[model samples]
Target: MPYRKYSELAELVEMMSMAVTSGRFMNKLDDGTYYNLQDSYETFPVKKFENAKKSYAQGIEEDEELLFLFDITLFGSATDGMIITNKKIYFKDFLEDPECIDYVEIDKIIDRKISDEECEMTLCHKGKATKIKIPRFQFFDHHFIQFIAGYAEILQQNNHLLAQGKAVLKDGVDNITDIIFDAFWNGKKVEKIR
Candidate 1:
């Protein structure tokens, strides 16, 4: 399966970093095109492998998953003020994992406007509301560096899902001709059933 070239991943990280730092949502416009506010700038660049490795070592020693995730999130926030946010898919395994426990600590950083009497807790985009505990912090630390590390790991593991065709770039365009032509020709030659 094809993976995103390192350059492409770098570009994506840069764009996300910029969006978070500027307090702008990276939403698609009604025209089906993507754009960001011009005034926005990246909080920080993603750390290189050497730096990540060093931090990972320290993180493992801390035996704190939230700290680890926080480290990852803050990777991008080092240059600018912390302004990162995290959104997990919310799965059983994720909740059970110690690392995930740390990840949930992100809620502490969000700034919710609701008061304790008005607050309601709901499951991942579903289920009935229930009374729940709220943490002291309202938002996750918007650390750009840590976010870079965590997101990069996710992308690396799931790169196969992004494959559209063989790895080839011609004249600055991703080449998908081989896969497309092969599929078209082979599709025509398949045997028909009565």
Candidate 2:
């Protein structure tokens, strides 16, 4: 995976850190492009990851158009073994454990925090708080880091809106109960904790 390349991941993370600290906000335009609204004065178009997993069900590849749409909707947010679509977040067992790949709806995420060293995500389901953390050194994946940073923005925005009593889309939540479930568990049949 590209993220396993530590130098590449480190470089990318460093760039992102700079981008964040530069006091410029990356605004996504309606035409699937992004531009810096503050100081950097940069503009770029969205790029799709050809190596993205085509599907959660083995042997089924994701369509290029669909993947492109996913990238545009999520602003090129993706990583090996993990994908954040408009409706849900899908993930595979990268640890080679005996668990099944699964997904969580986008509406389920509640809050999250992304720091330089780690990402702490908090999910609320059935009146319970589920937390998931990804440490930087242990899993040097670009997609994971990107997701943490990008989704952190959405999570914070949604959280702020909620505090103001506004309705917002589901953005970031730590709903993955077990990173490793039964291998036979398919992407379907995921249920909220009712």
Model 1 lDDT on a 0 to 1 scale: 0.26
Q: Give the lowest summed-lDDT range of ten residues in model 1.
A: 63-72
Where model 1 places Cα greater than 4 Å from the true spot, the runs are 1-3, 23-194
Residue-by-residue lDDT tens digits, candidate 1, 101-179: 2222222222223443222232211222212222112221122223433343433323333354332334111122222
Best model per lDDT: 2
Q: For candidate 2, what is the TM-score? A: 0.27
Find the candidate with the highest TM-score and give its number. Answer: 2
Regions more than 4 Å wrong, model 2: 1-51, 54-81, 96-111, 125-194
lDDT of 2: 0.34
lDDT per residue as tens, model 2, 78-109:
22233333223434323332112113312354
Report the C-alpha displacement of residue 89, candidate 2, in angstroms. Answer: 1.2
Per-residue lDDT of 164 in model 2: 64
lDDT of candidates 1 onward, in order? 0.26, 0.34
